[model samples]
Target: MDRGTTDRTLLSPERRRADRTRLIDGVVDVLVIGGGVTGAGAALDAASRGLSVGLLEARDWAAGTSSRSSKLIHGGLRYLEQLAFPLVHEALQERSRLVTTIAPHLVRPLPFLLPLTSPVWQRAYYGAGVALYDALGAALTADRGVPTHRHLSRRAALAEFPGLRRDAIRGAIRYWDAQVDDARHTLAVVRTAAGLGAAALSSARVTALLRDGGDDAAPVVGVRVADLTDGSSFVVRARSVVAATGVWSDDVGEMLGDAAPSLRVRASKGVHLVVPRDAIDGGEFARGASGGVATAGGPDEQRPGLILRTPTSVLFVIPWGEQWIVGTTDTPWRLDRDHPAASSADIGYLLGQVNRVLTRPLTPDRIIGVYAGLRPLLAGEADQTSRLSREHAVVTPAPGLVLVAGGKYTTYRVMAADAVDAATEGLPGVPESRTAQLPLVGAHRWNAVKDAAPDLAAAAGLPEDTVARLLQRHGDQVGAVLALAASDPELARPLPGAPAHLAAEVVHAVTAEGALHLDDVLTRRTRVSITTPHRGTESARAVAELMRGVLGWDDERTDREVAHYEARVAAERESQRMPDDRTADAARLGAPDVRAAV
Candidate 1:
């Protein structure tokens, strides 16, 4: 009943404790299972609709597919090939809302170059398609700030990006799409939901679907939860339950003894590589591609991100701050769901595809990071997972239970609205979704904070770029982070090993953001894992030491956390060396999950 607490927006250890107590004690209007983008979005949407909501995550937010996406917020240009026009249009609208209204600080436009290898018909076909794509975006929303598509000559394409081989193509088409730090975006959604009176907690797993009389065929009433963090178990009562569990959707169906799946979600593994900006061409790309700052002016105007048509799916060489993200092999995967390992073969496949256009090839030694994520695709008569629909399905297989599956990263808000609509279909007088107008935690004062960066940097005795990046990552919340740095002189300096991030940020991740472990802070909260060459290994112990006091960890616990992280990195390295998925899965499983049994 009391929603006026200052700690509501802070996902601190204290808040987690309080929310867990509240979850155990009270019956909520809606209970959401999952903490990825869609689940977090649903929580924010439902809470803003004036519902008492409970959000539970078996792990940290976006720990799975959400964090490991291609990180693009677009209408899926390739979907046009499938003629999924309505899906494209809906995604375009959501993309506009994210850029202009909801998360300008987090989501902004980035340009891309689509090379035409066969100059004549290829140019006409792709040029027309791209023109339609741009027109669709413009028609849906007035000037989303994404530039219109432009035709480029062979010479002009080389001028824009010299990464392509000289003899590779005839010309190119340049267009715009948005990019985001997906993990942070998901965390912001969670915080925004918490601020709106949703009791959100992570590292909490639902072991069973609770029934009133404990009958197998009885309608679901609540859940039996296991706290993965502390090894405690509890019960939760809710009027309705929504499973946005993604690839794990079928597991939810099994809990209710439902033989039929409302939404058949097949796991399609998408593997990506993070390499230095120079790796594309090695020399010319180093000079041009690393030009722009992230989340602000965007990646280099001349050296736009590349979209190459693979024999299977589209491949992207998207530019980040100092690195380039080259990715995504979409093949059916039937391996471990928690950690989808990228095998040497997957790596070879991606490298082999991107190398078709590159003047200089990418080698394993040049890779900074490797990650794999499973896409929850709707099962269809089509054999290939790529042929599966991007549109989501929501259904109530049993009374008081809702399952949502099969959607992409860009349209999570829409998916959330639909899931909430289905979950509360019988509940009278529930208001329509208010999330379209709502901005996440850092979005509110982002514009003003961005403009004040130089002054804020000077005042804080930090570099302008550092301040700007902080503003970009935390949005209006930069002030809170700055306050932490000002309080202690020692925390103001750059972190050891990972100089791009401040020492204060490691502290803030726990105190304000809901970072329960080293993995949460380094991997999701800051992206130290993917950006740094050592993949957060060199920075592990130091980060743990910074968080030790805040998390009340003794020397043993601190050392254990560091050990788990190092082991995780080592296991990932071994996995990447493996030639196939089964071997990679076994290698990755060498290091057990940091979380204990429930």
Candidate 2:
């Protein structure tokens, strides 16, 4: 399809209204529950195979574990220690597929430094593991987009990362992995699937499962979905249903009636802290303290990133634009899943672990944002959550229902392919998965569009950096966003609070992306919530006003939306200050869900 036609295929409000009608009218080949990365991938895989598909999500896309990931697409380096060679190998292959052909715009290469503490044995120990990691990646994909690993001397390591305390590290090993805006990548997958004729709907909850024979022996046939936006329920008939809910797998499994779930999902909470890049970098902090003195090469130029071995788990201090993302704490969590609360202890644990290696310590005041997510781990004999397998499993507890669980974000595509493969059993003429070779909506002509970024920047009257950021986020679809700016020059202006994003992008979030609420736009559609000091509260009103035109919200509705978003931010901030999970959960629950309130 042409670009304009493709843009029209977006999950806009009009398309969503039409999709609801079509979903209730037709019997589709496959119905997917959940709109996270895996479910989105499943929709794309099934739709591209010529199967009629519909995907439904209870909340916004990537509102769960998918958005709050460590954001690295790597063959788990630590998985090698557990001898999960096959798992690591598979993830490495998928990583290459993502960085090269699939969604190159969203995913890119990033360098990491693994510091050497002990002199000789530490270097050799890490060197062999990293070499094997690189070798596995090279063997799996012909063009492993990332570079190989190399060793650095003590002096060389210090030169590369001045943030590391000289006494803390002996040397360092440099390696390459890929990173992504996880939420954006997930949304792009959904958009790509929708363009391929898949029915994608958010804020639609699966209230119950439909049966063909109305008994325990009966096969699962479809689902009764409740439109959370309008409080209307409709039945979507399908030949098969795939439950891809991450942490809520068991809850869906209950819909099987008397059939016991073969697998159980354990929630492991992981929290991340977003702080200014200068917080942990000594040189930048020193420069800032000295009346904004300019440095030749900035803090990021000096230190790419760092990964430290903590007592509980590995801590990664990743470079993200003008900010640094440090995390994460892996602990057992049985609290609320909708809003996983990161307690004061969780923040303290991360800060202490990361501070162990840093020359300049990071305090609570430096933290701009904090988010917690749960990993849907397969229940195993291992008591510790870290020991649970990263490998995924696909099970058919009933004739028509397929459940997929227990996989890392890096291997979501493989998990989705497996789920669809299981769901297509006994069906005739279903084609093999073509998603591996199929690039996402914006990725098809990304290289050509990226090459023209400079000219596009000049024509649009935007800084080259702004255009580059747009290209990385939107790929060839950047033209559609630029078109909005062209028609209204004001749309080209940067957002007042979050200057990294343009106002046009906010409008695109509503018109093109399936952003049903202001929280969806601020937190998931863009990184404004995490990147800004006010947690996007300062820009919430402006974004809501921009969205009002597209959504047809009146003045009162706009005020309500902004107020709801602000309440959510306040609750999150309060939760972060709480001492324990119990108090944190209570604090987070203080913010009423906008859908529920409506």
Please state every model's RMSD to the true fold in angstroms: 2.8, 4.0
* Cα deviation of 334, candidate 2, in Å: 0.6
lDDT of 2 by residue, 177-263 (tens): 888889999998999898888998999999999988868878888999889998988999999999999999999988886885779
User: How displaced is residue 202 in candidate 1, in Å?
Assistant: 0.3
Which regions of candidate 2 fall more than 4 Å away from where they truly are?
282-303
Q: CA shift at 65, candidate 1, in angstroms?
A: 0.6
Q: Give each model's whole-structure lDDT.
A: 0.86, 0.87
Model 2 pairs whose backbones collide: none
- Show model 1 residue runs off by greater than 4 Å: 1-7, 214-217, 259-262, 281-302
For residues 511-581, could you state the per-residue lDDT of candidate 1 as single tens digits?
88899899998899988898888899999999999999798899988999999999999999999999999
Model 1: pairs clashing at backbone N, Cα or C within 3 Å: none
Q: 403, model 2: CA deviation in Å?
A: 0.3
